[model samples]
Target: MKVTKEEVAYIAKLSNLMLTPEQAEKQAEEFSNILNHFDTINQENLTGIEMYSFEDEPLRLRKDEAIPFKNSDELYANTKSMQETAIKIPKVVE
Candidate 1:
């Protein structure tokens, strides 16, 4: 469960992040602690526990419907970034 600084650095690179050495160390400690917490949960005894089921009552999902909103102009007017009808977002993919 010991997350190394190298692993954190690799993950940061994959995520397009530029983290300092201090930040990477802090992230490594945080990740290791999270893994340790999961390890503690896995060690719990769960014998003779009746598993909960939803067979008695089936969930009913409502039909999806599109309702037109009238105040969209006010919402779109607040943002300066726009590309025709859609909002212009910054490209993040490397």
Candidate 2:
């Protein structure tokens, strides 16, 4: 699955890319190598492989606990504009 210069040019044109002659040649070589790697992988034998959706063991998650913040007012003390409980930003559209 070799990518030719003409193929690279066509791809670049379709993608709306501005590629120099050198860049196009380099990209073609890289793309060809990637396709060759995929071809090599397709030649492998995986007769009894188990597909994994998650880790083998169940994950231990932390218990949900409410932790009170100390000096919470300091976080919003430097705001230029704010409501009673939230920061305010200017409207973008009229």
User: How many steric overlaps does candidate 2 have?
Assistant: 0
lDDT at 73, model 2: 82
Indicate the TM-score of model 1. Answer: 0.63
Error of 2 at 11 (Å): 0.4
Tens-digit per-residue lDDT, 23-44, candidate 2 = 9899999999998888986788
Each prediction's TM-score against the native?
0.63, 0.42
RMSD of each: 3.9, 7.7
**Where is model 2 poorest over a 10-residue stretch in terms of lDDT?**
50-59
> Which residue pairs in candidate 1 have backbone atoms (N, alpha carbon, C) closer than 3 angstroms, thus clashing?
none
Highest-lDDT candidate: 1
Off by over 4 Å in 2: 41-94
CA lDDT for candidate 2: 0.87
